[model samples]
Target chain A: MKERKSEGNEVKVRWYGYIVLVIAILFFSGVFTAFEGPLKALDFTNLAGDFGKLGTLEEGAGSLASNFRGTGGAGAKDAWMFAMTLFPTVMFALGVVKVVEYLDGLKAAQKLLTPLLRPLMGLPGISGLTLIASLQSADAGASMLNTLAEEGEITEKEKNIFAAFQFSGGGTLTNYLSSCAALFAFMTVPILVPLAVVIAFKIVGANLMRIYLNKVCKQ
Target chain B: MDKKVTPKKTVVDAFVEGARNGFGISANSMAPNVMFAFVLIQILNLTGLSDILGVIFQPVMGIFGLPGVAATVLIASFLSMGGGVGVAASLYSSGLINGTHISIMIPAIMLMGALLQYMGRILGTANVDNKYYPQLFAICFINAILSMFVMRLIVSL
Candidate 1:
């Protein structure tokens, strides 16, 4: 009897330890203190017109006006900058995806991801490539899934599930590493914490979407 | 596995085909979508229409700790990430928003950005029926809102 009681206590302690570990991970990932203190300290009303050595806010406004006035404005410049920064990455990622598809690399990826993703994502193994492509461009991922659906490798239901997954935060890596990452470069806080937190929530959102699709869109 | 000998294309052929497919999709679909959002937001900013929209959305955005002016950024983001980035950069450089705001807002923005094009180009190109577009969009939007709350919680902690 005493041995059994001790064994039960040990199991309880183990469970407590696991719970503590989970909380620790959450804390370290910045899930607990994400935007609170910083937001309270922000001055959102005044346009900081001259930040990071950029021209005054008035000049910026003028540039924005010029952009619309058909005189090369800040608006036009930013638009050009956006395209220059983003489209190349999109093109590169899409090209890589096409090559992977053409070479039948997806089959290998599917085989590897099936056992791992089946239980976690409720998706077929082949949809793994789609997930990875989504990290680059959601469009690429969606197109890949469509191709799979056309080949009859995945059903309409699975397509919806995969779409939900990709749709939640598509182009995650690309956006983070390029555009969003640039935004964070000058911040006081560490980038990893927010990155980890966002990724974790995206997974949650994706799985929630999977459950929703399963219940409502039964095929 | 019946590994049938598939006709192999040369390296140059594979590369060329992939490049064409990539460039074509971006130029045909993605580029137009991003450009549309970019131009529209610029027009709105220039015309001061964004301020009116910002006033309308202030209360809603305030609930999430965002400034009223964020309405314009959010609208632009809802159309494309490139637009979102452009707006965010302008706002940031102008001192309208700071790093903390950007950090908190980034996740939700990433999740919610590019709705119209994502639905029309990505899913449509996949040949999904038009009927499901609304439902899919709702799912993504809800997910983004939920992530916003999560981001808020993270920042607040």
Candidate 2:
């Protein structure tokens, strides 16, 4: 009975410790307002004007194509413009992530994360590779799991636990870059509170999934 | 224990390697989705479809602790992970939302990755028999919603 009580206390302390650590990280990351003040004061009229000019050029091309071919080229033109603008950024981000990995950054990252993640997630040290890969590239993470399964690095049981943790915890960097702009648009007190709640929920949700898989699924 | 150890690469080498790996992954997976999203958003913008969608989603936006106008970013973020970023950039570039809005939205967006769903699909492919996909999705979706609510509450205070 004393041991059980002590164990309970330990769990409670650990849980609260996790919460405090997460909150501290978020507060310090400046991820909350990396570009708030300057972006808000920018002159939008000129930017809109630039977009208008691009639109006009697109329109001109569409009219020319329609006059010659009797089919409006607006859709094609819009698609092309959008592709031209967004593709490079995605490519650039992907490239950066890859280079990070090829240089053994992920291996180093795995070593650093292994100590904390293994105990916290109840996963093996090898699982760190999958988690780190997931952060940069979701597909890579999945592939890593598959490879591990093939190599028998982990049992079917371990695989399920790994899956639960990865599913809940993967894809941090990509998500951040993708949503940074949208978040900047509606920054307000009301918005901030919900955002913080979501952050907490994500952390707790992932941890809960880890615990459930470990304790309940006795593969 | 005496296996020969490889020396650590320099920072520049690491950066270059990371870039290369990133390029390969992007080309294979992320690029196609990004293209699809870009095309979709462009068509929406041109045909004013986004505005129409914005109007439709306004009420739902309130439930999520966002303004009616902010629905555009939320929906965009959902459709194309980067769509929200584009919307935010446009709004900020246009001087529509202030710094406070930017601050609030950044963390919310950062924490809003569809990792749960993404992981579920990957695990499904791996033939892992534990059917926790629904539970995982629910946890992530609920967490995201709850986080947003809590963030709003804290910032409001």
> What tens-digit string does per-residue lDDT give for candidate 2 at B97-121?
4555455454444444544356555
Write candidate 1's Cα lDDT for B55-122 as tens digits.
88889988878777776666777877656755765566456677766766777777777777777656
Identify the runs in model 2 with alpha carbons over 4 angstroms from their true place: A1-108, A147-158, A174-203, A211-219, B1-13, B20-56, B69-80, B83-121, B150-157
lDDT (0-100) at residue A193 of candidate 2? 41
Computed on C-alpha atoms, the DockQ of candidate 1 is 0.21
In TM-score terms, which candidate is top? Answer: 1
Q: First chain of model 2: TM-score?
A: 0.48
Best candidate, DockQ-wise?
2
Say which docking band candidate 1 falls in: incorrect
Clashes of each: 13, 38
TM-score of 1: 0.60
lDDT of 2 by residue, A105-206 (tens): 445545556776556655666666667666655567777887787888777666765665445434555544333312422445422243334434545765
lDDT of 2: 0.50
